[model samples]
Target: MIDWLHPSVLLMLGMLPLIWLRGRARQIWQVTLPAIILGLITTLAAGSQLSLSFMGLELTPLRVDKLSLVFAYVIGIILIIGNIFALQVEDRAQHIAAGLYGASALGVVLAGDLVTLYVFWEIMMIASVWLIWRRKTPIAYEAGMRYLLVHALGGMLLFVGVIGYYLATGSVAFEKIDVDGWAFWLILIAFLINAAVPPLHAWLPDAYPEATVTGTVFLSALTTKTAVYTLMRGYPGLELLLWLGVAMTLYGVIYATLINDIRRLLSYHIISQVGYMVAGVGMGTALALNGTAAHAFTHILYKALLLMGAGAVLQMTGRSRMSDLGGLYRYMPMTFLLYMVGALSISAFPLFSGFVSKTMIVEAAAVDYRGVVYLLMLLAACGTFLSTGLKLPYFTFFGKDSGLRPKEPPINMQIAMGIAAALCFLIGIFPGALYAILPFPVDYNAYTLSHLLKELQLLFFVGLGFVVVIRYAGGKDYIALDVDWLYRGPGRRLVIHTRNMIAEANHDVRAEFMRFLAKLQTRLGKAHLDGSLLRTWATGSMALWTALVLALVLVLTLGT
Candidate 1:
């Protein structure tokens, strides 16, 4: 029955019982559900469709194809791993939110029509906000509100686009939508917002680090990757995305280098790494598209692994800033070693997952003769190694001891990290395994000597430069201003200033009106006292005035 049912329904309905379950039963159910989802995902064949009619429209809630299948497979895998990692957490609501969040992502990828996609898209926004709010901190609450507002705006754009598209074309198919009209542009902007493209990306780093430790893992795995999936499905080869992706690759790393929060640092790199997939989608070649899918899959794994490591640090020490963490390798050696695997994988180190996948995008750019794009990607990769591989780990685990000695995270967490790290290495060592699942055939090799040497040499120089600048590379206790600063800083002040100005103007107007009323009252009092008008006028005089006014009105009306 689970296999026959849509994954979204199974996950949404299945997670509710978790609220009533306790202890081991909750843990067992949490882990069992994702496993069941994975099994169901495997059973799903491409071209499978499940549809029903609603409001005279056919809504396909389950539509399986190569593209959707790969995304579903990865989502299912991350859910199982994430649920295992979260076994020790006591909050059932967090688990439920994560489950619904994941179910919403599954719904988006499997949706066969714009209506189904939009429905899931909105649910994803609603469910994910709870993960941030679950932290119950003021900062988390504020961040979650901003996150919700941004996503809500995006959802509105998506809704408008879908409505416009349906009205114009009389179809709701969620397929390749070109950028020829307002509807397409609205849909594309909506996707870009979810993709965390810069100017629209502050919500990610602002909200993700504030989430519950385990919650960040799920947050890292889902939202942007889902956006990438939508882009790959709907807007591949859009030249604008190619340039925007290239800029994001650099913009993210630049900020990442300045970040002190370990999770926040990793969060910026998400934008950086996702830029690769976005670039590949922009290139629009078969090779580029395959590379995009591969990189997205691998990114979810290694990024989650990195966040798990950072979460472990936060859980044990109550500190997430690298300036507050150092010399932790001795106390958390397993954590250190496991986190390094993720670091290397994200850095595109040889025999790592990123080397297999990330290089594909760079290679795609080179093949397309995108010289500027290729060089920028390489530069971004160097920053990735410098910040993530060398800077973050060095400051967190290897730099001067901050006098904090914390033990490793729980066994289930270590197991989850181990599983993800192992998968990263395995996928790197055997690229064919990941490549086999791609929507396109593989004609690429990640291990060619030239490619290997080029990557190694790049990493080598980056490592050397980091060693030279080691003192300057450590985290500092300062906030780095980002695009969000515009709204959080000046934009907020502008609103307050405008509000104050309006209040002042209102006060001035009210005071002036009262003065005018008082003046009129005084004048009337003067007339009454002086017996100049009403007091002095006889009844005959008043009646004669009224009769003359009436006679004038009657004469004017007769003449007209």
Candidate 2:
């Protein structure tokens, strides 16, 4: 019903035909041009909004605010970058899925009402699974199915929560509300699931590495960040989030440390990155909220950059397991450089994007007097430095030489990495550009002497620890147990066992019935052979036969 909502609708419709665009050039334009136009429109009229009413429900399809604008900007920008990264891909399905997936994310942030938000939420879920599925390997197919199954469960939770909310309050607008009962908690669980908060998080690390190279980039950037945006919008200051966020940070680092595959390790690292943002939302101060928004923006860029670098290695060498890869720095030095930028940024090294943004949240936790929480956040930061910043890059690019040579990836791919790498530095050096657009005003300085020295010392010690233990710190190629083991391991065995028991019981019942039938047939044949069935009714004989027949009927009817 919103007039300017027309552009988003039209853009999404435009993507449908991309499924048939087989030519590489057409794919590029199809994926990138609409994103460019949408980005332009968003910048030019960043404050525009439109709303409509139907059946006593209010809907705002193109709501624009500072929070929505930041999320919209990233998804729009990433669309172009992601497609450029995927430019040489002949798979039209990836292009279509990426376009619609980006559209749904943009729609989610812009939607001012629950109806609009939930509709797009479901669309986003369905579209993303295709990206994994289109990888077209057995692993990809199975991972995609599991991914779908999990999100579908989340969607059902959201559906129930939304309906219960509207029924309880007679309002369906997507705004902050008191957690009165089942409605709020149900919806919260759904968001946490999407955000990859701990027990619910296995789906992300499980499925992302299985996606197409470019698809994983989009996957890493969009879904979890959308949850961050929504949580900031609707659930800031919720106390429970503090514990959940910290748990994710620590849990992710532990798994990421033990993970062997490069992309899979990075996938686990995402839970750590998102933890900072979620904890920021929980802190509920202006500084913390602003930091969450800033981190989300910067995280998207660097995380995508990391994935792009990993994808480059995967593409060139056809190997992603670090044990099978090394010494590629000599062959693909540009990749090494771009990848290190991402690593440094994510590690929150001084003067990189992450240091500038992530410091704000840790500061917020301190200012709020959440000292224990602050300590945990600090510990998680150290773990991040150990795993992502040190171990991943070392094993992939600089560690043991596996004697495999791989060239730099395609120009478009390199350009994508370069652009992302540039933004990581750009935001770090010029924090004001990112700060200016935050929903809250920013006054924090990240580069003051104490802050810089503190961050450097932390990184230094973590790096030293890694160096001292390098001989014993190699990645093991064994699966690390996680919450998914319940379903995929023991839970699966339980279901199969229950099914087998039921099958065995059914077989026994059938066998008993067949045996009874066989016995009856044998008795009838014997009776016929002896001609007892043609008994003459002599008085005593008839009386005795009738008495036997009555007893048999009684046994069959009651005694048995």
Candidate 3:
């Protein structure tokens, strides 16, 4: 019998019925199912394990621990929010894709062994690309293709790494690996790719903006965060991640400032914010790891809120570029209000979720005595405020009047954002609620007077600079090229040229073979016509041969 109560199984099962259901039924099913999953996840006790045998190997597909539960609870909550946001969408496929994508991520979090994690990891990639494709635009299609290809590469590396690790050690348990050997490096690279670390990071901004308005909300929540969870589980304390994480924070903020599309701007910040979690994991201290988990949970809520606001703008105005949008706040007052909640939360403003969570990572750097890293992270925080907190909303909602008046999005959309916005505020006000579920005990306080003063000073100056240079700070309509240019430009041309060369060679070989066959046929026809090999003289020749063979047979018989 199937374990219908299994969290992943329940999620997948809920989605399969969506294909056949429609209208009110589908919406109800999708909404209620996630709530149910959330309830189930909360009830799961830590140290719970569900084991089975597969191919003579013991497999634990469900491993409930504090770490996995943290990811599970947040993922479950996001599923509800994303489903409610998408309630107005008639596309069942999109809902199914979002559900499966969340389920797969949850599966990875709960997986007890490397093989189980890899299985869910690959599924997560496959399910997510569809959200991008569901937009049904040419750019969306291309972006989806790129997203699929990058993750496929990551999946391949992960599969090979799993095999190598299994061979190196006679186990496939998913845990912190010793930082040495081909297996470790390969696995780490795979995780980094999914984590959107640097050059492997291009797929995120490339595809996220192209997804359907509602789809981007779910896209924003699950994939990269899941990779961060895996990093915390399997690769924490690897010092290399410390620097790489800081670099991502700066890299994302810079591009986010320059980007034109609203969703793209938000997408880049995903990289920037995830950098903090990555850096925390690298720190490997109890506080840092707790910060990573706390920030991840809070980031999901606030980031989803931010994306939902952007998606609403896109849905109502049918434009995502800040260059094409302005003065939307007058018409979208509620949207503007809720979006600011998220903005303040993400900006790490005092008395907000971001203030409570993001500071922990920065404080972790300080606690570790890494002054240089601390300063660089502080610099990235300034950029975050400049881009995501200031420039994005300013131009998108309050910049020069573009004379476009778009009303607020559907009620379901507002409710979704409300849920996320409320969570951001609640988490901010009640940090203890978030801290209680952390894998480690919490000892740090985020409400310190010194910390508050420091963050306030940083934001104040960043805001001042933006106001002084407001004209130059506005977004211009242009695609900023990133490292993806290598693949999307020259790399694409190389593939086309190689394909053309192969086609030419194939044509020549086929033509030559045809000519050879024709010549052989002609020669065979001539030989048959020139000799008595298969002609009308066969009767007389056959009779003579028969008589000679008869004489030889008689002589042989007599001799014998």
Residue-wise C-alpha lDDT for candidate 2, range 145-258, written one tens digit per residue: 988989999999999999988988888888885658999988998899999998899999899999999899999999999999889988999888877888888888888988
Cα lDDT listed for each candidate: 0.93, 0.87, 0.91
Query: Candidate 2, after superposition: displacement of residue 198 in Å?
Result: 0.6
The best-first sequence of candidates by TM-score reads 3, 1, 2
lDDT of 1 by residue, 1-560 (tens): 33358988988999989979999999999999999988888889888888888998888888898999889999999999899999999998899999999999999999999999999999999999999999989999999998999999999999999998888788888889953689999999999999999989999999999999999999999999999999999999999999999999999999999999999999999999999999899999989999999999999999999999999999999999999889999999999999999999999998999999999999999998889999999999999999989999999998898999788999999999999999999999988889988998989998999998999999999999999989888898998988888878999899999999999999999999989977876888877665344345788988999999999999999999
Q: Pick the candidate with the highest TM-score.
A: 3
Off-target runs (Cα >4 Å) in candidate 2 are 1-3, 44-47, 499-560
Residue by residue across 1-560, what tens digits does model 3's lDDT show? 12325798888987888989988988899899999888889888888888878886678898888999899999999999999999999998888999999999999999988999999999999999999999999999999999999999999999999989988887888888763699998899999999999979999999999999999998999999999999999988888898899999999999998999999999999999999999999999998999999999999999999999999999999999999998888999899899999999989998889999999989988998999999999998899888878898898889889899998999999999999999999999999999999999999899999999999999999999999999899889899999889899999999999999999999999999989977876888877655335345667888999999999999999999
Instruction: Write down the worst ten-residue block by lDDT for model 2.
Output: 1-10
Candidate 3 colliding pairs, count = 0
TM-score of 1: 0.90
Model 3 per-residue lDDT at 138? 95
Q: Tell how far residue 344 is off in model 1, in angstroms.
A: 0.7
Task: Report lDDT (Cα) of residue 474, candidate 1.
Answer: 85
